[model samples]
Target: MNYEEARAYLDSRVSYEKRGMPESTELRLDRMVTLLEAIGSPHADFPIIHVAGTKGKGTTSTMIASMLTGTGRKVALHTSPHFERVEERAVISGEPIPGDRFTRLVEEIASVVEEIDAKLAPDQPGLTFFEITIALAMLYFSREQVDAAVVEVGMGGRLDSTNVVIPVVSVITSISFDHTNRLGNTLAAIAREKAGIIKTGRPVVSGVVKEEPASVIREVCRHLHAPLREAGPDFVDQYHSKGLAGGRVEVSTWRRSWPPLDVALPGRHQGANIALAAATCDTLEELGWTLPTEQLKQGLRLCRVPGRIETIRRHPLVITDVAHNEASASALVAAIPSRPEIPPSSPSPPRVLIFGSSVDKDWRAMLAILLPHFSHAILARYVAHGRAVEPSTMVEDASRAGIPVLTAETPARAWEEALRLAGTTEEPQEPASSDLDVAPLPDEPMICITGSFFLVAEMRTMMPLAEASVRPISS
Candidate 1:
């Protein structure tokens, strides 16, 4: 089968809601591993860093991959819930493999899957979308012989297909209430699900510092005989200072100490992510993957993740982040540069938020958490699935929050409204600066495109940011 045919084959499978649990469709999935084994367990070829978390896993994974790549290792990255392209989930050398390459790989895997199908009994479902992608990434990584791979678990870790591998180090970034319908509601329960990646005797590194959930991870590590390196105490030491280019940072870890290190990403969460990445590097060192310090540092400085505090323009700058859950929304709100407090000659751009999300999400809670930062907001509907909170209802939620909200039937229309409102005014205003000094917003109004991951995916296609993908950059 060719690429198009392979995509069709995968697309013909059930949706997330339709498929529900893998076990329900167990009869259909027997050949997934069989197919992989037939192809030679490519996942076993490389040292893997498995990451699982509700909020910060993506950032943490990106940081670890950046550090490894900086060290000149050919690294493979597989992150889920792609913002734009399906190929975004799998990256080689920091670049998204093209549609042609992805299609070709899927075709190859499909051929093997077809061959193994006869062995499966009836009433069983076949591989789902994620399973196929995971298969492709592992097969591709193994075939290319990558030095290391950074994997972000697609969903709850235990049943997650990515759990099939034995990783060198398992990293759980931070845990919070999310996917309550699937992963559970309480922090400890969520922690248990995230802790599933803890393999017996494998080293697990985590940034969890709170009480209930962090305690849960500790318990699992003890049970598994896995050494759990705590994020702050055992691995990372924090330092902060002012910088000329961006902000100054201090990162002290079990491996090394870099006080007043300059980091580009904004917010305290980023500081945590950096620390986690450092801890990850330390864990790798123990396993004999000693990378040069310069590369790690340079890689940290150079790493750029889009749709998560991505700056699009200057002067009314358009800062976009893909923060959907409560914890994530809180972080995004905290990161928005507040207009200067000091009296100035000029005024700041109004903070306009353009939000959208799946219908099942806790939109009320998510919107409430971010009410402080949004001077004005608009809600957009889902473009992919019809089951999204309507923009009109979102306006009602905003009204209760005492924040004015505009609405659009679809996100594409919402984008135009947000733009107009962000720059909209009955009259013009001036600019200003301050000494106690919060960072400044850019020339254009900041548009935070968030809610459903699918909405952000659509936004990237409709309104492209400067440039970001899995593809590597050339000098």
Candidate 2:
């Protein structure tokens, strides 16, 4: 009936994220379906928006919830992989579930969870950590009488516990190569798993652009007779600008067009994410939700996700982004100032990158995508439930990529070394340039710490004044 007890109960359950999905456990909806049925099917009490994809699901979900909440509706947003605390997974009206309330809910559900587990066979692991989390979110939203709930798939969609909900609109963000072992190897294969969220007669919005994956989604929509709205020609996001500060884009849907909107998240790819959220809202509009352009713009301007090109410091700039896979890694690199091709001609400040990755991730592809952009790289192991790829493996990857790298004992040490390397100015400086043609002295050398969410969370804890939860900064 307290935070510690709740945490201990959750920690004891089978966590697929911590211990990679096992062959012994079956991935199916039967358990969740039964569990919800036993608990009175709380998810059916309210309308839901189901989101699934390899990336951008969290951002898109947050944007939709923000807009709904801004319109004076009580919204529930459920996401995964909490950066600081477990309570982050279930938020109502832009606020985390209160500790006392969470404790009461945990106590309330313990009996049902025990009853279900007791009925399962000895060899079967019935309910997982993720499933319990989903149950808790649904129960809480139903109890609170929320107007709507935004549920993000914890992983690949088909068998994900959150799939138990029949959403009013299903949104699938960009699909890429991630969790290949669990999902599948080819894009088409991955798209098949992601498309499982589509339901008969439910409107589906897809942001997947790869030809193969797009084709798969189209076929699934056609077969299911789900109304499909693609992001390319049907919904458009025209890029305006992108930088560490933020990004700007003009999003257009069939219903309406908005002027250049400020996306608090950095990177041009976020333009696509914003467009996806817009399309989702437009779908809700058809479902009879009152969402005006002013409210939509307010929500877009107010939504900011931390650890995604998040700036923690200004002087001797220190940035932290969670770019674990190859696709996200490329986006992170594009956000940073790259080294000029002609060394001295259009010189950028010295770049130092501090990196770490999961043992199961595509290190070779990620390293090849990111290492060349930095002048110096520091590699280290991150502390997390899953093991980090060893520095030796990183060394080999960097060597094959023809880039020099320095190793550290831990992420904290890597941060320290990055600061030391970034501050060092050994090269003799050219005489202060009075010529206007010469770009005025570039800002101090940049330090970018990325590669894993654990690394960013750890680094944020070390920085002064860094809070566990982050929201958009009002300019």
Candidate 3:
């Protein structure tokens, strides 16, 4: 099969990412286990670091993989929701899987998938897109003889396809109210699903500091006899400063204390993720891996996750981030340069917010947090996926948030609208009161494209030199 054919084969299966999870579909790891058994149990060939969380798991996973690679180890990093290409989900030593290799792997797995489909029980669901992808990644990593694989859970940890592997260390980042319908609504309930990755006698690195979630992780660890390394108490990250370039943070663990280091990813929230990655590396060292301090520092300085506060353009300062929910939106708002507080009497509009989100997300709450940071918002639907919340549905939310809103048919059109708005500026008028806080605006206005990964992906395609960029994929 060629690349296109492989894509078609994968797309034909049931994908919860494209279509919202159906109540009729029962999520279980049995199907994944059966498939792996039929394929010679490739997941057992290497050590794994399983990561699950609501927000920062992907970043944390990438950081771990990059650091390991910096130590001259061949590491396999598997993440979900590709932005541009499907191969982005599987990375070996900082490079995406080649198209030809991906196609051949899909062809190899096709027959096994059919064989399993034929023997399934009547009520059992067939292999899903996520399950197949995980199997393929495992098979490829085994074939390549990777030293370690960092697998980021696609969803909740208990039944996620990636959960089949026995990881050396399980990492759970912060937990919040994302996917509340599937994973329980409360923090404790959600923490239960995330803590499912903690195995018997294995060590766990948890970034959850909230009492409700942290307590859940602690109980699970205690019951399983697993070592627990809580973020606030065991390891900590202190934020130094943030800029358009990146943020500086100082990380401290039981093993050592590191000076303030520049994190490639933006946002002060990444301070926690960096600390988690550092602590995980410390655990790996305890597990008999040689990771030098300099190499770890190099990995942290050079690592980049494309869509997380990525600046695609210089003029007008177009930034794209996948901040789909309330916590992420709040972080994005805080990470970006502080907006000049416009007085009520000012006529010119402030910075532009180009946004979209999925139907399952708490978009109303997200808007409440995001709208206050921008004077105008251009709403659009991402065409790559079917779960986008309608632009019209959010009109009232924007109005209630006291921000003027405009709707576009698609993400591309939204970009057009944003550029048009950013290009025009009214003469600067003196404030009615001298007491008002007024920060000077740059010569080029700023535009932020965010909300959903699909929206960010679509906007990314419109950026200059986009094809030559890192070519990000999503979950």
Candidate 4:
């Protein structure tokens, strides 16, 4: 079987992330367990770093993997909700597995996956796309004999398929109210599901700061006898400053202190993520893994998370961030350059937003945080996954909230309209026409494209040669 055929088969299965997981039903881990056992339990072959949280887990996982690889060890990284292609979820030493190898791994597991599906109980759904994908990652890691693997939890941790591995150190980035319908409605409740990744005697590092969620995590760690290291009190990061490019900060942990660090990912919150990565590396040291301090610093400086607050253009300042929830929306809001911050003598560029969101997100809440900051918003739908909330629905919500919002049939239209509307003093700019005559604004405006990862993926196609790194496109 070829890569295209393998992807087609995987896409045919149900996806819990795109379609919400069944409410109030226990996630069926039996299928994943059976499939793994039949495939020789490849996850047991290497040490694993399991990461879970409402947000920032992907960044933290990528950071840890980069550190491990910097020490000259072959590392495997498994993350979820890929921006552009399915292969982005499974990568080795910063490169995705080869197409031929990905295809072969899928073919190797196809028989076992089908056998497990046939034996599922009547009310239960069979193995999901995420489960099969993670199984494939573990099998590939075993085949390559990686020194370590960093696995990010798909959603809530207790029943997540990636939870099958008992990691050397489990890291939870931050607990927030996302996927509330499936995870929980309250902070403490959501933290409980996240805390499920903590195993007995395994050290756990958490970046959760709020008292409610932190309390839940503490309780879970106590019950499981897992050593707990909190981020703020145990390993603190002093954020000196930040910009659209990245930030500078100093990370101090219980083990030792490192000089000021440069993180390539934008947003001030990444300082805390860097701290989490540093703390996890300290834990790995206790486990007898040797990562020199210089190597860890090298990894922190060179790491670049692709779509999180990614700047794709400079002239009009086009940026794409995959911040889909209210908490993350606030982070994106904080990262944007405010007009007031510019010296009064200098011209401040107006911020214009092009937005799209999934059906399951708190779009109203997210808009509440993001809209007021932008001069105006161009609302659009991400149709790539068929999961976006309708653009018309966003228009109504923005109207009810007394915000200026314009509708676009698609993300590309929204991008064009934002470019056209930026720096204009006009009230409520209309949708753009192909040949509309308008003068460029005297000062360039910053255009932010955000809402869902799917939207970012679509925007990537429209980026110019200098804007994006060239890579193989999955057909």
Error of 1 at 361 (Å): 1.9
lDDT of 1 by residue, 1-475 (tens): 6666766787776556323343423422335567668788888899899999988888889888987898888998998877666787788778887788888888777777766655555765555677778888888888788898999987778767788888999999999888787778799999998998899999999899888999999999999999989976786655452311134456777767754445556666787888888888877888887777777887777776766665544344555677878888887776666544644665656677778877667888888887667778888776676667777777766877676778888767876777677765222222222211334434435556776667776766664344322224211
Error of 3 at 175 (Å): 1.0
- Sorted on lDDT, highest at the top, how do the candidates line up? 3, 4, 2, 1
Where model 3 places Cα greater than 4 Å from the true spot, the runs are 341-349, 424-441, 465-475
| Selected candidate, larger TM-score, 1 vs 2 | 2
True-structure Cα RMSD, model 4? 5.5
Candidate 4 residue spans exceeding 4 A from truth: 24-26, 340-350, 400-403, 423-442, 465-475
TM-score for each prediction? 0.88, 0.91, 0.93, 0.91
Q: Please state the error at residue 266 of candidate 3 in Å.
A: 1.3
Candidate 1: global Cα-lDDT?
Answer: 0.73
Model 4, span 388-441: residue lDDT tens: 888988887776545567999887688778767764333222223211112223
Mind giving the per-residue lDDT tens digits that candidate 2 earns over 1-475? 6789998898889988777675524887888887788778999999999999998888888888887777777889999877777788888877778888788888887889999999888978858888888888888899999999999998889878888889999999989999898889999999999999999989999999889999999999999999999988689998765555577888889888877788657778888988998888888889888887776777777776778877655445667888888899888888665554444665556678888888778878887888788778888877766567777677876776555689986877887787677775232132211221122236557678888877777777777522312653221
Clashing pairs in 2: none
- Let me know the TM-score candidate 3 reaches against the reference structure: 0.93
lDDT of the structure predicted as candidate 3: 0.83
RMSD versus native structure for model 1: 4.3
lDDT of 4 at 80: 91
